[model samples]
Every structure is written in C-alpha cells, then in structure tokens.
Target: MRSQENGPIKIDGIDKMILNAFMENANIPVSQLAKDLGISNTAVHQRIKKLETSGVIDSTKVIVNPTVLGYSTMSFVGVFMNKPSSYKLVLNSLEEIPEVIEAHFTTGNYGIFLKILCRDNLHLMNVLNQKIQQIEGVTRTETIISLEQPIVRQIKL
Candidate 1:
C-alpha cells in the first residue's frame, strides 16, 4: 500500500481482496489465493510482499485458547498509579507477569488498563494482591471479569 502526500495508506480492490482472504485463513496457500483472485501466483506473492513491507500486514499469529490451557478466567483491570511518573516502572513490572496478556495506557479514571487471564477467581486474586498490588507505583486496581466474549473480530477492510 502506498499513500498520496503521506496521507492514509491507499489499498486497491485487489489488496482488499487479498487481505480479506488472509483474514479468513492466514495459512491459505498463495496458489489457492491466486486462483480465487484470478491472479498469477507471482503477482499474489509480490502483492503480499509489498503489503508486508509497507507494514499493512503484521505478523501471522497462532490463536491460543486459554481455556484449553486451564486459564478459564479473563479479567480487565484498571490500575491506579501512585504517581504519573511511575507509569514506566509499573508497566515494566506488569510485563513480568505472564497472566497480563494485554496492557494499554489509557485516558479516564485509570492510568493503565490490563487484560489478565488466570485459572480461577482465586488465581486472579493472587495475581491482583500478590503481584499487581505489590508493585511500588501501583496504588489500587478495579477488575471486571468477562463472563463471555460474544464478539471478537478485526476491522473490516
């Protein structure tokens, strides 16, 4: 994808088609995608290369099911900081905790918001009290347990 005047990256219909196909199945063979798109394998390969080089396509990842691994609890925690300057330190410390799957420096009532996965409520409690709360810059936390994730998707191209 290339942009005009360094504006938003522009993608043609073909690029959108390729991206949509990959979004459905990342492991789709280039030849199959080429056949579906009515393009040569070389063209498909070149387009994918261009997309990757332009940073339009990030890395392909294997989606892991946390429940299968005994991680049944998913919680969102809003972390309150003792001071604004302590953010980096708190963030660095949070990175050490494996249960913290995602963290965001956000606006509003929280300094940092985190997505945590654990085996159960007790495991979550342990993480919150013994791990997150123990961090020097961390003052308090508010957690919301996710009972079900009804919708999870990427933005439509």
Candidate 2:
C-alpha cells in the first residue's frame, strides 16, 4: 500500500471519502470534512495524518497559472542526447534553467521530453539557443508549442 509505483494504496471507505474531498480542495478544513462526513474533527485529522504517513497523499502545493504571470508560451521539447551516459549531466543542467518546468526520461526516440514555459516565442527561442542547446551533451531538440490546452486534470480517484 505504501509503494508509490505499485499503483493506488490500500485504503478503506472513509479514507477514500477523505481523499476525494482533499483532492477536490487541498485547503479544505478538516472540521468541514468531518462535519460533511458525520465524523469527529479529531478522526478527520488522524485520517489525514495516516494518509500522509502512508504516502497516499504527497505534499500539498498551490497551483499557479502561467498565463497570469505573463508566461504565455508552453512548449514540449524532445531532446536528443549525444550519449545515454549524458542523461544525468543534461538533467542537472536542465534543472538549473528556470524555463524548463518539467522533464521526463522516456523510452522513445528521444532521450528526454521537456515541458518549457516562456514569456513568448522569442523568449522560448532564447532559452532553447542560450540555455538548453548550449548544454554539452545535447545533440538536438524538436519543440512543439501548445496553441491551447483544453483538458488538464489530476488522475481520478
């Protein structure tokens, strides 16, 4: 149940209800959840603690909107590394760049896939040329700019 890679945790009906409520609004007060579930506030608090200790719930974070920050460009870049051994080095370099929001090692033609956010196309180009492409082991990259994102959601519980 505690293994993250083994899929969902082993949880009871009450845990499921608490999780669903948390997933909808991470900041929801435990007292509110307790009242809604017809349970004591202490019970709700203990359930939350258990969920965290058991790894069912990770850290709660505020989700920020890129558009509001004037970062209008979102690009997916497939990076081709010079060698497989260079992955660690490239990843370290990518992590240093503020524009590279997310990176995933994959089993496809490319070595790594990157999600980058920028102020505009020009900013993206600057980041690609001055930062990403300048890495020692980066051979090439193919980037696709997202025109629109219609669907974005967390996994269904």
- The lDDT leader among the candidates is 1
Q: Give the per-residue lDDT of model 1 (tens digit) for 1-157.
A: 5743587778899999999989989999999999999999999999999888787888889999989989999999999998999999999999999999999999999999999999999999999999999999999999999999999888879
Cα RMSD for predicted model 1: 1.5
What does candidate 2 score on TM? 0.93
**Model 1, residue 133: what's the lDDT?**
99
Model 2: CA > 4 A from native: 1-8
Error of 2 at 22 (Å): 1.5
* lDDT of candidate 2 over 72-111, digit per residue (tens): 9999999999999999999999999999999999998899
Residue 12 of model 1, lDDT score: 94
Report lDDT (CA) for all predictions: 0.95, 0.92
